[model samples]
Target: MTLYTFFGCLLTAYGPILSIFFLFIAKNAQHVLLTVASIAIQELFRWLYFLLMQRAEPGLNMVTKYPRSPFNRIIFAFVAGYGYALTTSLVSYVPILVESLGPGILMVPSFPAASTFFDAAVTTSFFSLLHMAWMVIAFDGFAAKKWVGSLKIGWVLASHLGASYSTLLNTSTIPFGCIYAMVIQIVFLLISVAIIVASLAKKR
Candidate 1:
């Protein structure tokens, strides 16, 4: 039971991530490279990485954020998507995920059918998927040079804030707190999916 719980939570957390990468990124060489660099460069030369990205500001920045070709669009999206998903937010969770490898399964009282690890795993997967959507909408604004005035990106930002706030309810003190958090994230994720699909439709 203990090992089952551990692996169950482990797969729950990373399964979606693996699936998405395989479906969308693995086949694309550029995507695979960017994903690797996104995490690797940052870890290897933390200071130099930011310094260089800033230094590459003129050429690389414009190509990434205000890309002209369909290719550049993919470039920017990958940068933003992987950047947001694989950054500090991911690193911070690694240590805590050790909880998923437990001596016993820990259930959430307020949401008894779900274990705490499972709840956390679901939240993690949702964030990763949402980050992908966010990049698409955000790229629309950036490429259009409507950074401050883009309603689409603004909506994504607002949803992120609201989702973060809702996570506070992931506690026993609040009845159905975990349930509320899960529902909130699911709703946001659906909206994100719509945004991604809409963007893809526009491309087609």
Candidate 2:
């Protein structure tokens, strides 16, 4: 059950990743097509990145190994991701209160009617939490062990930092204000390091 929760989080980013790319392209049939394409592209990159990481550090390869039951993993991953969406959506609503206090503080972009500030915020948060869970599950499946929440925290920090850098520096489609992104990155890095230390201690 816990393992499923972890996998759920990691694989849950599919919808958000696809939606981001879809926002870049023209809004037509191409949007749907691009969303599908983004999924394929992301999966390709994920596997490729895993392979590269495994080569660099064979020990980490356990994190990416598929579980005993592919169907179970899939169902659990989606359920975990979707379940997290509820929490994320609630967190996202807080921004609305922020907007009432002031504008441009967050600066959400205009996309599909459904992808507005409220929707995006919720979805983003959902994926973030889900990915965090995914990392823990992957660790259990691959590492065949569990520890204090520290390791998951560290992994999430590393993943968040990498994702933010790619989105902010490489891609020009930053959805949040500069200040907000910086703050989030800082928090993510700190939490991630803490997680890593905890996991390491457990290992020792």
Candidate 3:
């Protein structure tokens, strides 16, 4: 997942440059098309990055090693997810947000400042929680030596892509305020923390 985010950041840096070309040629729902294309590209890049990382660091395969407590898994997931989100927001979203502030760059719709912040906060928290879920499930499957473990990488990528697409689509319909988004993020964090605590207690 960390590798995924690193590749995502790289793509995010280049996305705008491509958007410039797309802006000139694309017509009718250009922004929407761009969003989908971006997600697809990111997923592809993420997969390739994962393969490269696995080759470079063979030890990563030991991710399934046993004796890893659920509490530790949860913490690792949350932290990794948060780190991904932070890098993504700072490296990817911030520039787009800035661009949006300008006279509506072609193919890039300008969002209100509040909307941008709300979107960022919500997306960061949502993906973080999603990562946590993925880690827990993947680890459990691996520890049990289930075939499901083999599918964890693909599952995480697919889920991330699906969630990103859905979130982009829903943004228009849901239209959350900053305060509401913040509250939701906080609630998710607290719930995840509670789950981690529960896991720790169970181990004890």
Of the candidates shown, which would achieve the greatest lDDT relative to the real structure?
1
TM-score order, best first, reads 1, 3, 2
Clashes of each: 0, 7, 0
Q: Please estimate how well model 2 matches the true structure, expressed as its whole-model Cα lDDT.
A: 0.39
lDDT of 2 by residue, 29-56 (tens): 4223322332322321433433332353
Report residue 25 deviation for candidate 3 (angstroms): 46
**Which residue ranges in model 3 land beyond 4 Å of their true spot?**
1-70, 96-117, 148-155, 170-204
Cα lDDT tens digits for candidate 1, 1-204: 366766776677777777767887777665676566656543234334434444554565453434455445535465546655666446645655786675666777777777777787777777776766666565564445444427775766788788878777876577788889889988988887786677667766
Which ten residues in a row are the worst by lDDT in model 2? 35-44
Model 3 gets an lDDT of 0.42
| Cand. 3 TM to true fold | 0.39
Runs off by more than 4 Å, candidate 2: 1-68, 94-154, 160-204
Candidate 3 or 2, higher lDDT = 3
**Cα miss at 77, model 3 (Å)?**
4.3
- TM-score-wise, the better of 1 and 3 is 1
- What is the per-residue lDDT of model 3 for residues 1-204, given as tens digits with 9 covering 90 to 100? 243443454354434433433563233243233223333223235434333333533343244344344443433333333333334545645554454444432321233443343355345545545544544433333333355445555555555555555545333534443345445444544554554455457656
Alpha carbon lDDT at 203, candidate 3: 58
Task: Give all candidates' CA lDDT scores.
Answer: 0.65, 0.39, 0.42
